[model samples]
Target: MKYEISGKKRFSAFSLYTLSFLSGVVMGLTVAPVGAWFLAWIALAPLWILIIKNEKLKIKNSGEKSSFLIALAWGIGYHGVALSWITGIHPMNWLGVPWWPSLAITLFCWAFVSLWGGIFVAVWATVMARVAQQQPWLRVLIGTAVWCGLESLWSAGPLWWSSLAYTQSPHNLVILHLGQISGPNTVTAAIAAINGLIAEAWINRQYRNKYLAIASGIFITCHLIGLLLYSRPIAQPPAAALKVGIIQGNIPNKIKLLPEGLRRALTGYTNGYLTLVDQGVNAVLTPEGALPFFQRDLMRTSLASAVQQKGVVVWIGAFGERGRSYTNSLFNVTGNGEITSRYDKAKLVPLGEYIPFENILGGIVQRLSPLDEHQVPGLPNQIFDTPFGRAIVGICYESAFPDVFRRQAANGGQFILSSSNDAHYSAAMPLQHHAQDIMRAIETDRWTARATNTGYSAFVNPHGKTLWISGYNTYETHAEIIYRRQTQTLYVRWGDWLTPILLGLSALGWGVNIFWQNDGNTELRS
Candidate 1:
């Protein structure tokens, strides 16, 4: 005969918290760059279980630090494990830095990035304990809303940068389709909703009963909506055939800064353009920072002359330095070798492009990539007039943000030109990178021609289908992208309206729960 312990122990609380965080990590690891997104549902089950157990034990009501500590510990564990892939770059001898130092830095970076999601979870757990009390549905709804609100408010949060939702990527076909309406924020909110549902089920101890039934209904509703949206086929614009060639000059990020390697890098790009010209391509697009050095009048050079002689337009990506500030710029070269139009990259990478607090982190910037004191942010949503058609240019991380592309489309951008270099970051980033391009395509209802330095070059149609894509393991030699244009999508017109409304509804729901004690008591049993 075994003696049974009647009370909830501190160890059990720790175990539950640990399990919640671990589930998040496992869920994150399953999505993108590695497309095992089916785990999103699986990961939420444990969190739901814990929430139910916590309510039954009245741990949320207990005047104890156990719950808080458990949540924090779980957050740390989840972020630490999920973002481990970022640390992969640390071991490599980048810029002659030693492995240990790189590893330490990488780990710290991952830790910082993971903290956003952890903080959201911790706060949600606390809020549900206080406001929702023992009401599971209200608890889940509040938790999801608060998390999504924070994600929107703090765009710089870990949830924004290195997010679990981003990992779901192109494989999360349903969410990717939803991205057309609300962008990635919708997918993120959906993940939070799923997690909250799981937590509520566990708290109520009705995990297999009403919980499954409700979750199935919600899932089916979302899936049906996504299917209907995708089923509405978009019509392509009937424009004259314009042959375009996208050059993916796989320039090594390390040697790009060296003075000696400048010639080689420039030659590589020139040769790629020449090949495209030889193939009788009407337009050629190059990857971002294809030119190591920048000249004020790049189009007047010999490189432009050869392309002009070929009677084709060439779009060159380079770092344009003006007075101490540098801008990621795209130059449009005419057949007569003239700089017809230029569009500077608007959305700059936080740390990679420009550090927020340069006064304090200027030294750190110098140590990392070869960026100067500051890389100036460009004007929001500038469209370049290409020879073949009107094109919106998304440079590097600029593609990830919907506003950038939305504004361009509104300004008469018929197609998209995305130039990125993922070599400086880990190779694994391209999977999500690819997904982002597709989402942008669906949002704008325009075809996208993405040319990356390392890999992930592709042509994505308005239907969120990849007409062309390259492998990620190694550098693709070159890509000559050609695609038809599509009309503007509804999502491009209304950028992220659903997410804000959901956030407002969530707040209202919680307000009702908190202010009206009578309703709260009635729902406590439900």
Candidate 2:
């Protein structure tokens, strides 16, 4: 059955799919870099209307196929646009990958990841289509729950940086504050529920007024609560504040692995550290892989000697040896230049740090990865103990996962230190990555200091404000006063308590819907 676009106009299956895809593209534009955050509130309405209104065709197998395809199209557009930075892997001739092959590999990676993301949305649409006949309230609840549940599940898997919550980060600070209650999923659920209500109002003429009223109430209430949370004072007057320095070495990805690059990195970080020390900063941070050498090799360098002579604490990102394997790790060096603490990266980038199915793929996997050897992942729940206080730490890719930072805060981390190497990608990745840090700061109520190799080195307060940020591809050093507070937000105390509840509710709703439909069908047959 063709879907009606208006009173007389109609949309064919292809038109519906195209429209769904376009709607997703619009939603993608609402996220970071572009940051048209308001668009996110209504961006999914068109797609929802298309899927729910088209349920009349459910008697035919074509209906299921069409719904899945439409949602898949939408997902592809959303993830494709939001994750467009994946294309930066191209021109890998620097890694010895030829031109055409490099372009092919980059495009393939982009399409593969986009397709994976699209699959989650398609599954949600397919299930929701079965319940299109339910009450608007039920539909909205189930839709929001399923969406949040799937996002939580996706977060547990690999490659999940484009959550709906991030659309508000550093832009809609009021909305972002809701993350303190139940993490980013709370914000994601709110967005999904709002869009679901708007779509229901647009499609259900009988209940349009009711749905709109409820939607407005929810929208207003969320902002009000957010305002209260955002304004609530978490700062401690007696808490000690440390002057921290962030170093952005600005080394190009091409030469970063070469001998000359190593020398430059050493000099750059050493000079940045000495300068910051002169400014009276208590601690200094370098980006991930800023020193490509292992800890043993790094400590012998003049940089380590400088730290000892100056008697200032420094957090250095370098490789750590774990038996036969290497780890992407952050080391905490004391005033005496002794490595007192270390936090190894838990979330490793697939095919970048370590190859999956290495034995099966053999030499082919090496060609795809830039690393000389596979790196071992760190154990979970690692925190860095510094002179200032206990600190949450995240290496390059770990910023995308909220639980990593949450665990640290719950375990008594007073502040956050995220180190990254974003020199491989364009400005888009670093900016988005920075936005993720902002959300983490608000959620855990911890001041964050992020140091990156290329750019977007930043310091964010507990309120998701970027106090200081550096430009991309520039050598820069900045210091900010960050507090070490022991206060834990609800999110840190409870840790994503909403996800399991939402999943259970969605499951129960689905089961009840199925049982009710069966009972009605039995009565009709009798």
Worst 10 residues of 2 by lDDT: 55-64
Off by over 4 Å in 1: 1-14, 48-56, 60-82, 91-100, 156-159, 162-164, 206-208, 237-242, 300-302, 363-373, 473-486, 514-526
Model 2 agreement with the true structure over 394-495: per-residue lDDT tens digits = 898999999999999989898899999987776789989999999999999989999999989999999988988998889999999998888888898898
Q: Estimated TM-score per prediction?
A: 0.86, 0.96
Q: What C-alpha lDDT do the candidate models reach, one value each?
A: 0.67, 0.88
Best by TM-score: 2
Candidate achieving the largest lDDT:
2
Which runs in model 2 stand beyond 4 Å of their true positions?
1-7, 57-61, 236-239, 507-526
